[model samples]
Target chain A: GAGVSQTPSNKVTEKGKYVELRCDPISGHTALYWYRQSLGQGPEFLIYFQGTGAADDSGLPNDRFFAVRPEGSVSTLKIQRTERGDSAVYLCASSASGTGGMSGGYTFGSGTRLTVV
Target chain B: DQQVKQNSPSLSVQEGRISILNCDYTNSMFDYFLWYKKYPAEGPTFLISISSIKDKNEDGRFTVFLNKSAKHLSLHIVPSQPGDSAVYFCAASALRGGSNYKLTFGKGTLLTVNP
Candidate 1:
């Protein structure tokens, strides 16, 4: 992909409904990151993936939120039993890693706006 | 607790003047800092960055200054232009080995440049 791509740019679901947001990172990028941005707040880190394994999951808000990067390429962020408070934009970013110096800066997707009513 | 903080919620600057956006962080472990610009409805775009080793970095009209001692940083836009008007966020991370690095961002400062 020319840039990081996220699906279902806008999603609306009733509270308690499960929703899944998808992200397709740039080709050959090895590091993928997920972030959640609420109204009037900066993007908060949720999880990060290095290859198929999650290197750090400390930022996940709670058990209700989870993400996976099975092939280390396309990833999905799943929210179970969503609440109205979960309404916000989910952002995904990718960067080339491995010598640890991909400082080219992260390429981010437009983001998915999820509204939990 | 917010590791990164942008005190000003909004800023209005006259076009062609200087616009200085400030940010502060409580985490001393954050050695890498970055500034991102976002337009309405668009994800943040990386503007400039400064590593722990350097006190300042410049990229065209964007410059990021890092003061490790104060745990503060600021983005300065000289001769600010209307096109430069947008929401600016400050992010910080340790950048440890890359994979362990996770960016912590501030609430962001909205800069409205008026002509």
Candidate 2:
């Protein structure tokens, strides 16, 4: 793919409903990330994946949010018992990065706007 | 414990003038910084970035300055245009497990260019 792609551009779910958001990063990108952006704020880090294992999950808001990148190419973000406060845009980004220095940039997806009512 | 902070929620600038958006971070351990521009209904696009070793980096109309000592970085857009009217976010990343891939972003600053 030319860029990152996120499924279900918009998701409207009721409180307590479980929803899954998917992200397809660049074909060969090994580093994938998930972020949540609330209104009037920047994208907040949620989780990052290096290959099949999650490198950092510290950013996940709580036990309700979980993400996985099975093959290191595509990822999914799952929300359990969605809350009204969970209404926000979920973003995905990938880069050809392995370490620090003048490296490549991250390409972000259009983002999935998840609205919990 | 917000690692990055963009104090201004919004900024209005006249077209053809310079627009400077500032950001400050609390972590001295962060080794890299980046700036991204985002429009409504679209994801943020990578604009410019600066390494902790460098004080400044520029690309066309976009210039990013990093002051490691102050834990501050700024993005300067020359001759601001309506096309540049979007929310800008500052992000930082640290090395972990032989890679620095995760990024912590600030609460963006919306830049509106008035003609």
Candidate 3:
């Protein structure tokens, strides 16, 4: 793919329901990342993956927020028992490498807007 | 605590004039800084970046200035155009070894360039 792709561009889920957001990164991208942005705030880092392994999950808000990059090409963000406070945009980004030395910068997908009602 | 801060919520500038967006950070460990532009319903696009080793970086119409002592950075757009109107976000990364290079971002400043 020429860019990162995120599924369910918009999602409206009821409180306590589970929602899953998917991201298909660019071909051959070795690093994948997930971020969440609330209204009037910048994107907040959630998790990061290097290959099929999660190199950093320290940013995950809590146990309800989880993400996985099983095949290293596509990733999924799962929110269990979603709350109203969880309503926001979930973004996915990919970079050529996990190192900051990659000059080009990370490519981000449009993102999935989740509305927890 | 907001490690990164964009105090100004909005900025307006006339076409052909320089538009400056400001940002400040509290974390001195951050070694890389980046700027991104975003439109409604769209994801942010990378604009420019500067390494801590350098005080200034320029690319075409965009320039980023970093002041390590003050933990401040600013993005300047030369001859601002209406098309440049968008929300601009400032991000910083520590670039720690074996880390995933996570970025900390500011609240963002909305730049409105009028023609």
Pairs of residues clashing in candidate 2 = none
Q: Could you tell me the lDDT of residue B72 within candidate 3?
A: 96
lDDT of 1 at A109: 91
What is each predicted model's overall lDDT from 0 to 1?
A: 0.88, 0.87, 0.91
> In candidate 3, residue B30 scores what lDDT?
80
Q: Where in model 3 is the C-alpha error above 4 Å?
A: A100-102, B96-100
DockQ score for model 1: 0.53
Worst 10 residues of 3 chain A by lDDT: A97-106
Q: DockQ (Cα-based) per candidate? A: 0.53, 0.56, 0.62
lDDT of 2 by residue, A1-117 (tens): 999999999999999999999999988888888888998777887887878899889889999999988777889999999999999999998877544212555788999999999
Clashing pairs in 1: none
Give the poorly placed runs of model 2, Cα more than 4 Å off. A98-102, B96-99
Q: Which of 1 and 2 is ahead in TM-score?
A: 1
Query: Which lDDT value does model 2 have at A33?
Result: 85
Better of 2 and 3 by TM-score: 3
User: Which 10 consecutive residues of model 2 chain A have the lowest summed lDDT?
Assistant: A96-105
Ranking of all predicted structures according to lDDT, beginning with the best and ending with the worst: 3, 1, 2
Off by over 4 Å in 1: A98-102, B96-100
